[model samples]
Target: MARNKYDVDEVLEDKFDVNQLKRLLAYLIPYRKRFVSVGFMMLSASAFTMLIPQFFQKVMDVCIPNKDMKGIAFYSFLTLLAAFYSAFSLRYKIKYTNQIGQQIIHDMRYDIFEHLQELPFSYYDDRPHGKIQVRVVNYVNSISDLLSNGILNTITDLCNLVFIIVFMLILNVRLTLVCLCGLPILAIVIVVIKKKQRTAWQVQSNKQSNLNAYIAESINGIRVTQSFVREDVNSGIFNNLSGSYRKSWMRAVMFNFTMGPSIDIISIITTAAIYVLGVSWMINGETGITVGVLVAFTAYIGRFWAPINTLAGFYNSLLTAISYLERIFETIDEPVVVKDREDAVEMPPIHGDVAFDHVTFSYEPGVPILKDVSFHANQGQSFAVVGPTGAGKTTLVNLLSRFYNVDSGRILIDGIDIAGVTIRSLRKQMGVMMQDSFIFSGTIMDNIRYGNFSATDEEVIRAAKTVCAHDFIMEMENGYQTQVNERGSRLSAGQRQLISFARALLADPKILILDEATSSIDTETEIILQKGLNELLKGRTSFIIAHRLSTIKNSSCIMYVDKGTILEKGTHDELMAQKGEYYKLYMSQYASLM
Candidate 1:
């Protein structure tokens, strides 16, 4: 297997980008009303909370001092009303915010998936499946809590903090000023610690993505590992990945743990100073500072620090989310390398005259794959391409399907340049069957119908029978309804190939491409499959890439490709008569059989 060339873990820079955020907020436009409703409820809840301290101050300074029972009862009832308002407003705020958050996630996930579909094959060629899976599943999910509760809670904290300061000043400017003496130090600590936490979290996110990629690759290739008896070696690799994740997480935790203590120490020293100053004012008779006023001041200080602590914690959460947000936005912003032109038109139902007009192409710069290649397959003709491995045979067929665009020249079907037509229309008329057929998790009947969703039960059965898969399928316990499991692991390679053939035949596509479709099957199965393939190729232009020269000997035209160019083109006998590259390949296969 080729080593994965992609670097899955990239260090993040610019923990926050306002432009990326503005783009993300576009998904929430549809839910603006819900956001508005949540904002209002959040502010109402904060206001009601602010009223609680005032009630406490009044009861301490007035009701208790007067020994007034009615006053105490009235204040208690008012406090109860404030509590009720706070609770209900918070309930609605949480409900609305969560609704909006879920909606945004849904939209964002859908858009990411759609964008993945539109991305070119080359994009996936170098990337790992696990990294993409993490972005779509885990990274996208990471933002849910931040969007739903974090934003509104942060707003509420700020409101409470501001209202507390205003109330503290009205109560006693001197005490309030004394209580906030440590404010500058607290602010600086929070800013410094939060920056460190954000960088730590970025490292953690990278570690997480790397771990996920490893697990996905390991699971997908478990058979190879087991065959090679490398379980211990693989396990050691997994341990290393998991250990990195743990180390990063703990490093982040260290920063998180230190924050609470640092804030608390500052808060404690500030509270002690307030007491010392207020008591001295009373003892010296320098001010009318009663016990009630002193108690209220202490209570107000607690109120002020509570939001400060809460905001600090909220900032921690926001920093962590920013890392994931950067990754999510990066994926959504990826450009679709293959897209239709502005004036491209839908392809009419094709007559399947495929022509490669002196096409040249390369997967990467300075390394050409197909060099000035050209060919034509008239409607209803069978063209066979035989080549050594990596000779660009597959690339040729891929160009015809428009899976990748050419560097120069054009591919035309019935005199229409494929690039000039819409991708959906171009692909709809083509049916492709590969050697390693990808069988999705579904019943055999459903898999066949995947070729043509509108195909009926009878049509599906007919297609299977034509490919000689019906007999073996019926031998199974569930007949057509037998489950294939993931990648058709339950079926033999030959059976999978037959099912793929049946699927292609069912589509009745105008052009059919079979890339070594018979390579996996035994000779007996290939003979049966060949008969069905002959019938299927009767009315459609077909291209076959085969190593078994005998299977394509009767094709209308044969091309021998090598090193990014066509070395020979003629009927099989015509090439054999020339006794060149085609003759040598055919004779080599014939000699092997003997």
Candidate 2:
């Protein structure tokens, strides 16, 4: 319920969903045989435990009375064997349960990650990355024990409870009924606290997620926080989120602790009632009662309540796990908004004739990003799109690559609608270089080869040479094999861009779209990159967006876009001659240099 600068907690479910547990259990269905074996092992252990109390009762009633040493030794040996077998059963039970549990965790995490890969940019756009990560990691781990051991243990405990009840009835019907008196009272405690406990845990989960989001956000922006001296402010916010999580955890556990003691109180009161009544009845010369029966029945009382307490603890865990299950399943259920449509075929080899026909689109309804935008670019032609910030230049390129579906109208490549083909096939022949210039952690060679997996080391180096990245890379001791971390943190901005450029070109795409790709590079590198582009653009369709005049002056066509519309379009010389918006932007840059 708390909000901070970095994140807001997700909404809590108003009611417990039975289907979530059913679905969680469905994951175990594949290994039901293993779990079934666990159940039998657990039952056998309980049986052994039940028989121990019987041995004690026999010694007290018959063996001791007769002073029979052989009988005592026989029962003593049987008890040892029973304890040994019970321990053995439990050890194997734990082993199989853990193996099965880990596998289920692996499956759940894998499913969530695979689903995440298919999810669209919009899905990530709406939620914090840290929140999504918690569901995949922390939330899944929280329920691992429950899925692997808790359900089967609960079932086995219930069976143990039933067996104890049957043996109690066989001993004395009246005392059995007295024990039953505690059931309605214990059920009342559970019914009262179940909803409150579940709601508390749900809030706890949300708070933890919020705290994780802020922590992740802070770590990613720690440099900015330090540079701006916002560490104290950020730490204060973290403390508040951490405090909220602590409070919610305390509240949830308060309810969880309530269940165990309530069962204990009921058990103690019921046992005392049996003892008082049994003593008074024997004094009154009851024919059906005996000392051995009383001792055995009391031992059974201990056995009876043991499982009840275990069941109560299991119930508390179930409530806590249900909260996590809600989020994990919610993510898995997210729609893949940008996935390939049914009946989609592979796109034919591209010759790079791209067209947009009245391609109006919006990220949100009623607020268009690109309004009735239409254009045609023939194969081997380069177009320069100049636009002010938020003028839909980036969105235009995103739509061209089918990162999102257009709201209305169609975008065509080689006279075929892109939506008619599989997304993988459509994007395979096109290269996209965005402003970020992300570089993964690896040898420089591996990072360049990422977009084009089949490119040999020689080809990778060739692409690097074209983008003028080869010089700096070769200067390093390892040349192309030099290690670089994520985002190329060890490299300069210009070097990172050059490496990214090489990566894009290595794909040998027929249609290349570069959105502010050269913005990070220095003038010297940009000039060299321009020379490479002249040769590369000879047979490929290219859309280049940049603010520098040198980057776009030689383009076959220049488009000046503002407020989601193209204000002017022509060759650089023609737009300059027209003295339009493009002329004003160019003059301003020229004046700034002066």
Candidate 3:
């Protein structure tokens, strides 16, 4: 397996780009109605909240000073109405924002899932399973928070700030102007901290993803680690990744933790200045501002700073959320390399005549895996490929199914170029059994039915019988209803192979490809599978990548592959008589079996 190469610094730097954040926010456009409702509720709350100080001014200036009990009662009732409105507005804002947030999360998760489905096989090969999983889960969740709470709260806070400032100025311009002197400084500080924290948090998030990928790889390959006795080495690597994550987190936290308190300290100093100046002016009879008005101004000053401080605290979360959005957007933006061509047509059902017309392929440019590998299998013919490991035998099967497109030349199914055919239509006519069989976590019946979802119970049983797997399946405790544990851990390798054979048999495809299907089985089971396979191969164009020499001895033709090309091609008897590459390979393998 190739080692993963991921750089935390590169991923982090990419996260801070403004374009990435803007694109992520664009997902919220479809939920504009909910956002509008939430905005209205926020505005209403701010309006009512701003009225409270004016109500206090009213009670002091007109009601209490006049000694008019009726006037005081009326003013108090109006204050109560404002409080009710504020409470009602808050309720609506909470309900709408939360609904909008959850809906955006749902849509984003679905979009990521759909994109993953459309991505090519090469994408998976180049990326780690754990990394992809972390991107899907962590990145999407972060984006959800960004859309729901971060953006919504930022908008509300800004609205509240505007309303508070306007009302404060209306009450006493001198006091408001004095308090506003600190606003520019606070804004500058927030901008600086936001920039620093964005970079730090992006680094932290990348480290987290890298760490998650490492952990996933370690856990999935624990068996290999244990067998190799390299647990301590693996632990050291994990510790190093986790340490990097921790250091990055602390760096981000250092900047973020200072923002809220720093803003509050500035607000406090501004408030103290206002109190001292107002008191001196009143004592000197230098202004018309009353003590009550000064006190209300102080309250409004606090309200002004409150939103700023809250927004400052939200900076860290915003950066983290944006980092997640960047990761998700990266995945969504990955080009689909194997998509159907615009004019691609649905392939007709196969009569099993497959032709490889100078088919050359390479996953990477300038490094070909199959070099001009041309061959043909007529209807009802069994062709065998004999090659050493890494001789591109399995690559041949992969090309036939269009798992990876060829770099040069073309493959034809019954004279129709595969490149012009819809992938679904092309794959539907084939049945493939890999060297390592995979049984999903489900009942035996379900596993077999996976080959043909619409297969009846009778059809499933018949398929199993055809593959000689029915007897063993019936002997199990729950028979066909038996549950296979994860990856069929509960079953022996041979049993899993038998079940896999049944699955392919159920599909009854015209074209069949078996890549070392019976190699893992015991001798007795292999013999049994051989009998079933002979019957299955009667009327299909089968390509077998055989490990056991006996299996390919009766094939219609045997192609000896070497260094990505066929060195020799002939029937088993003809090749044996030639005493060439095929003869040497067969004799060596036969000697091992003996």
Candidate 4:
């Protein structure tokens, strides 16, 4: 069976990956002062906590026994003072850590999103949106606690355990040794359980990614599902995915819960053994063990186990976070495959001459989409490409726009190799209107202004008028201010096409490309738009791809393409005189219309 998109690598290392942690810390360097302040606060809080038992021991042994009420009050006041200091330290620590963590998240998210924009179209073509979305939004959120509180909590817990150990030894060496006996057993239990915990968490993460990917894909294609009456089928698939997620999460939770009980049992047995040994020693008059000393030892023992349990929980969280951290780094580390050359310069204003000198290209190796294709268009000429489906019509426009580089040969503009010019400068001079007129979620006015950010409202209105969209705009409830849903689902296909046409016109580029531009427009609207389009194309180099026989009948030049090869190139009358592929196609379509 083929592996699914959500199958996360099962054998990824579960240890505390030092490199990942180091890279994550690089995001913290900007807030180093705040982070250091948080560390100092944590240390102060731990110190206060460690001192509490000492004060309690003094009260029991010296103050209460002797009925020294003044001493009792003084020591009690000290304890309260330590607690207040601890609280003060904690308040600043939390405030600083939260500020630092939130800033890091903001910077990291911004970097990821900006890098995504720099990546080429092929990157998006090869991956599912949901998988990328999860990495950007969900996986990034998983590390918030690990960054803000996890480090400080771990350090404080370790310090508390050490202080408890030292105090236990001072109060009574024999009892301390009994309590320490559980250390080796506890280590064994943690080592065994943590591996299982990490594995379970990794599986859980994969399951969650799968669920997210499914939901996003289904929602986008809901119309197809409803059309086919496959709602039941989709629900079944979703149930299976959700079920797997539940199972994986439960397995991880069980492993997490198992650690606490296992440690508790060992703790109880160690406490019982200490009591037995200490009581016997006191009775024999061999070991000088006082009641107050035993009380203090008991208190230290509880304190020691508290941190140990807390550390165990932290270890589990660290395990889960490590899995998520690796996922985040994978995306951040992806190489920018398409980048400008170091010495690339801005392209000068175009004179509208474009030439392809034996250009050959392919989306994948060993399968060419354009085979040694060569063409040229002079300034102010309307060049039309007419071909069957998959004849590389759209690919020609993509190459002109440098959406993808040619596999071999050169594409030149005004005798300059396009590859030597800066991409932004080259693309800024061309206006493209693709067959799929994708409209963003915004008002109709905003959508039209997207092509030229600096275009004024007057320019937008004029552009809409040129495309004959002004009539429909006034008929709408809000005129130009009407809201468009995502993908323009609320508008008809022809309206979306007209909006896109207006966008392209607003740019006022020297080169204009219309790839099946009038495909969605009704016959009447196409006639109106074409009259304005002809006037607009008078002084601009234009590339038109259309299947309708009459659409390109009067072009300056026409190329009939098939199987990535141009079979005929001529004017309409010249091509009809030759009686070749173009003539046959034109005559067949004309007969159908008649």
Which candidate comes out best when scored by TM-score?
2
TM-score of each: 0.95, 0.96, 0.93, 0.92
For model 2, the stretches where C-alpha displacement exceeds 4 angstroms are: 1-7, 12-16
Model 1: residue 515 alpha-carbon error in angstroms? 0.8
How well does model 3 score by local distance difference test? 0.83
Q: Cα lDDT of all candidates, in order?
A: 0.85, 0.88, 0.83, 0.85
Residue 246 displacement in candidate 4 (angstroms): 1.9
Stretches of candidate 4 off by over 4 Å are 1-17, 286-288
- Summarize candidate 2's per-residue lDDT along 1-594 as a digit string, tens digits: 112334576864334468777888889989999988889988988877787767877898889999988999999999999889888998998899999999999999999999998887767777777888899999999998897788888999999998899889888999999999999999999999988998899999989998888888888788799999998999899999999999999999999999888998999999999999988887898876778889999999998999889888888888899899888888787778898879899999999999999988888889998998899999999988997889999888999998888999999999999988999998889999999889999999999998988989999999998888899999998998899987788998888888889999999999999888788888877888888878777899999988877788989898898888888999999999999899899998897676
Q: Please give the ranking of all candidate structures by TM-score, highest first, separated by commas.
A: 2, 1, 3, 4
Regions of candidate 3 where Cα sits further than 4 Å from its true position = 1-17, 286-288, 592-594
Q: Give the worst 10-residue stretch by lDDT in candidate 2.
A: 1-10
Per-residue alpha-carbon lDDT of model 3 for 1-594, expressed as tens digits?
A: 233444333342243478876776777899888788778877777787787777777778777888888977887887788888888877887777778888888887888889999887788887667777877787777666667777877888998898888888887888888998998887787777777777777788778878888888888688799999999998899889999999998998898787777777888899899999999987888655886688678879889988887777566677667767777777887778787899999999889888999989888889998999888889999999988999999998988998888988989889999999999898888999998789999999999989799999999998888877899999999999998887788898888988898888888899999988888778787777788889999899999998787888889999999789999999999999999999999888787666
Candidate no. 1 TM-score: 0.95
Kindly list the per-residue Cα lDDT of model 4 for residues 259-299, writing each as its tens digit. Answer: 89988998999999988887778788756586677777877
**What range of 10 consecutive residues in model 1 has the weakest lDDT sum?**
1-10
* 592: Cα error in model 3, Å: 5.3
